[model samples]
Target: MEFAAVLLAAGASRRLGRPKQLLRRDGETLLRRGARLALASGAARTLVVLGARAEVLRGELDGLAVEIVLNPDWQDGMAASLAAAARALAGFDGAVLVLACDQPALELAHLHALRDGAAAAGCAATEHAGALGVPALIAPALWRDATDLRGDRGFGAGLAQAPDGAVWRLRAPELELDLDTPGDVDAAIARGWLDPA
Candidate 1:
C-alpha cells in the first residue's frame, strides 16, 4: 500500500535549552535524519513540519527529498504541527506515518515495518515502555481525528480515546530512546545509542 510520512519537528525544545531537532547523531541532525528515514521507507512523500527554527532547520534538510511545511502556530502545541501536516498531506490517498524528531535510535527498518504492518489497519502506533504512541501510521480515514487534536497533546490522545481495536500497536522498543533533554542525549551517547561524530 502507498503511504506518506510526516515528521513533527516544530517544538521549541524548552527543556533541552536548544533545538532538539538540531541534535546530531553521526553528523546528521535529528530532523534531517528522521526525514531521510521516512524518505527511504517506501513513503510516496515525506513532509517535515518546522516551526521553532524553521529557517535554520530548513538548511539542515538541505537537499533531502522531503517536503518542508512550516507551522506558524507551532507554539500552540504538537496538535498544531499535526494539523499542519494533515493539511499538507490532504491529497494523499493512503495512510500517513507520523514520527517525532527526537528519537535518536529510530531506524529506517522500523519505519518500514510500521508501514508494512499498517496495511489495512485503521492506525498503527509504536508500543514501547508499556505505552503506545507516535511513530504511528494513521490511515486517511483517521486524519480528521488527528487534525482535531488541540493543545500540547498529539494524535496519541486521540488514539487513547479510541475504542478497543481502533489502533494497532507495533512493538518497537527503539522508539523509547527519545532525546528530550541534554541528559537524555548524554545518556544515549554513553549508552552507544548514538554514533561518535
Candidate 2:
C-alpha cells in the first residue's frame, strides 16, 4: 500500500525527566532511528511531529528524508500531535503508520508486518500489555478519527473502542518496553538495547 509514516516525538518526556527522543541506541538517537525505520519501511513519505524540544529534536533528524511538523499544542497530549499529523496528511489517500520514538526494540520487520497485516483489515496494531497500540497502520478512511482525538489519548484508545475484530492485532510483547522513566532507561541500557548517556 502506498502510505505515509508519522513518527510521534513531540512529548516533553516528563516522566523520564529528559527527552527520550535523544536517547542513544546503537549510536543513533531514538528519534532518528524511528525515522529511518519508517523511511525504510516503504512509506512513500514520512512526517515527524515535533513540539517539546522541537529545535533540538529537529537536529536529531538532521538529513533524514522526512517532513518535520511542529505541534505547538503538544502539551495538550499525544492526540494533539496525531491531530497535527492528520492535518498535514489531509489529502493523502493511503494508509498511515504511526510510530513512537520511545520503543527501543522496534524493528523494520514489525513495521512491515503491520503494513501488510492492514492490507485487508484497513487497520493493524501491536497487541502488547493486553492493549492495541501504535506502531499501527490506519487506513485513510479512519484518518478523520485521528483529528477528532482529544487530550492525552492516542489511537490505541480508539482501537479499543472499536467493535471486536474491527482492527487487526499483531502479538508484539516486545513493544511493551517503552522508555517512559529513568528506570526504563536503565532497563534498556542493562538489556544492551541503549547506550548509557
Candidate 3:
C-alpha cells in the first residue's frame, strides 16, 4: 500500500550526552539509516521532524531528498514531533509508519506488516513493551487525531482508547529495542548497526 513514513529525529539524548540521531552506525548515521529504510520501503514521502541539535543532523540528511520539519517545541517530547509529522501528511492516504530515530535495528518487514494490517483498520501497531510501541500504520482517517497529539500523551494513548478489541498487534522484537542510553548504542553495534565503521 502507498503511504508516508514519519521519522522522529527530534529529542536530545541527555542520557547519551550526544544527539542519538547523529550517532554513526555502519557509516550511516541512525537518522540516515531510518530515513533510508522509510524511503526504500516505498513510502510516498518521508518527513523527518527535527528538534534540539537539528543542525547536526541536517548535514547527514543533506542529499536525502526528504521533507524536514523543525519542531521548536521538540524539547517538550516525542508528542510534539509526532504532531509536526502528522500535520505534514494531512492529505495523504494510507498510513504513516512512525519510527523512533534511535532504533536502527527496526526491520523494514516490521513496517510492512503494520502497513498491511492497517490497510483496513484505520490504525495498526507493532507489538512492543509486551503490547504496542510504534512502527504503526495509522490510516488517513485518523490524521486529525494523530496531528492533535499533545504533550507526552500520543497516538499510543489514543489507540488504547479504541473501544474493546479495536487494535491489531504485530509481534516484533526489534520494535522494542530503542537506543536511549550510551550502553544501548554500544549494544546495537553488535547487531551490525555500526558495521565495520
Candidate 4:
C-alpha cells in the first residue's frame, strides 16, 4: 500500500540541552539519517516537521528528497507536530507512517514492516519497552484522530487507546533507546549505538 512518512523532529530537546536531531553517528545527523531511512523505505512521500532550531535542522536535511513542514506551535509539544503532519497529509489515500528522529536504531526494514503490517492489519506500531508506540503506521481511517491529539501526547497515546486486535504490533527492542537526555546520549555511545563526541 502507498503511504507517506512523517518524521517528527520539532522538539527543542530541552532535556538533552542540545538538539538531539543533530546528534551524529558515523558522520550523519539523526535527522538526516531518519529522513534517508524514510525515503528508502519506499514511502510515497516523506515529510519532516521542523520547529525549534528549524534552520539548522533543515540544513541537516538539505538535498534529501523530502518535504519540510514547519510547525509554529512546536513549543506546545509533540501533538502540534503531529497535527501539522496530519494537516499536510489531509486527503491522502493510504496509511501514514509516523516516526521520530530520536530513535537511533531506526532502520528501513522496520519502516517497511510497519507499512506492510498496516496494509494487512489497518494499523501497526512498534512494541518496545512493554508499550505500543511510534514509529507507527496509522490507516487513513484514523488519520483525523491525529489532529485531535493535545499537548505532549502523540501517536503512542492513540495506539494505547486502540481496541485490542485493531493494531498489529512488531517487537523491536532497539527502538526502546531514544536519545532524550545527556545520559541517554552517554548510554547510546556506551552501547555503540552512537559515536562518542
Candidate 5:
C-alpha cells in the first residue's frame, strides 16, 4: 500500500473561467481536496504537479505533507504534468494512483479500490466493467510508460495501447463526476458534495 498519488493539477483551466483548483468548495480548494483524499487513501507520497497558477496553488498545499512539482511544460497538456511526476518517482514500486484535481467526487475509498484492483492485476492494469477509471492504480511494471509519457491525455492512453484488459473498475460513484464549470460546481453543491462556490 506504499504507493504514490500523482495529482495532475497542472492544466490551464481555460474552461473553468479561472483556475478550478483554487475555487473553494466545502471550504477547501479542489487541489487541496485531491491532495487530502490521496493522503487519506494511505499514499505515503503525494506528488502534486502544478502548472498555470503553480505559485498560487503552492500556498494551498502548504503544511499538507504533499510534495510539489511545477510542470513548465504544463501548457502543453496534462501529459506533461504526469511525466513530471512519473520522473520524480522513477524508482518507485507498488501502485501509482493518478487523479485529476478538479474531481471532487474522488474519495479515499475509491483510491483504495483502485489500489486493490491493481494489486490483483499484479503486473498489469486491472480490467473493469466500465471505461478505465482513476484513481486507477498502475503497478510498477507499468511505471516505465508513466515516466516516459509525453503530451497530454494522461497515461491511460498507454494503458489502452498496452494490449488491452489491464484496466480495473471500482464501481465507485466518485469517478463519475468531475466538476469543471460553474454549473458543475452548483450541481455538486445541490447534490451535497460541498459548498464549492
Candidate 6:
C-alpha cells in the first residue's frame, strides 16, 4: 500500500518543561528519530507537522525525506496537528498513518503491521496504555473523520465511530512508552532507547 505517515510533533511539551522536539539523545532529536522511523517503515511519504518552536524544530529535520508542515493553531491542541496533516495528504489516495513523536520505542515492524492492517480493515490501531490509539492507520475514507476531531482529546471520537470490527487491532507493547516528561526521557535513556549523550 502507498500509505503516508503523518507525524504529529507540534505539541509545546509543557509538562516536560522544555521543547521535547529538540530533546536529544544519541545526538538525534526526538522528532527526527520519529520521522526516520516513519520513513524506514516503508511509508510512501512522511509528513511532519510542526508548531510551537516551528523554526527551531524544522532544523532537526535537515536532510530528512519527510515533508514539513506548519500548524499555526497547534496551541489549540492535537486536533489541529491532525487536521493539518490530513489536509496535506488530501490529494493522495492511500491511507494516512498518524504517529506521535514521543513514542521512542515505536519500530519499523509496528508501523508495517499498521499499514498492512489498515489496507485490510480500512483503519488500524494499536492497543496501548490501556486504550486504542496511534500509531494508527486511517484509510482515505476515514481521513475526514480525523479532520473532524477537536480539542486536546484528539482522535478518540474518530476511533469510536469506526464500524464494528472494522478497526484492526495490533498488539504493540512498546506503544505504552512515551516521552511526556523529564522522567520519561530518563527512563527511555536508561532503557537504551538511545545512547546517553
TM-score of each: 0.92, 0.96, 0.88, 0.95, 0.86, 0.91
Q: How high is the CA lDDT of each candidate model?
A: 0.83, 0.90, 0.76, 0.88, 0.72, 0.83
User: Model 5, range 20-137, lDDT digits (tens) per residue?
Assistant: 7876667888889888888887877988989887887899998899889888998888767877888888777767877787766666767776777666654233233444545667
Give each prediction's root-mean-square deviation over alpha carbons: 1.8, 1.2, 2.1, 1.2, 2.6, 1.7
Residues forming the 10-long window of minimal summed lDDT in candidate 3: 188-197
Residue-level lDDT of model 6, residues 93-142, one tens digit each, is: 88788888888777788888887887778888988765788888877777
lDDT of 1 by residue, 138-195 (tens): 8777776677888987766666666787777877776787877878888788876665
Better candidate by lDDT, 2 or 5: 2
Per-residue alpha-carbon lDDT of candidate 2 for residues 26-135, written as tens digits (9 for 90 to 100): 89999999999999999998999999989878888888889999999999999999999999998888889999999998999999899888886778999987888889
Ranking of candidates on lDDT, top first = 2, 4, 6, 1, 3, 5
Backbone clash total for model 6 is: 0
Model 2 residue 14 lDDT score: 94
lDDT of 2 at 171: 91
Candidate 5 positional error at 3, Å = 1.4
Q: Which ten residues in a row have the lowest lDDT in candidate 2?
A: 157-166
Total clashing residue pairs per candidate?
0, 0, 1, 0, 6, 0
The reply for model 1, stretches above 4 Å from the true place, is 161-166, 195-197
Comparing 1 with 4 on lDDT, the higher-scoring candidate is 4
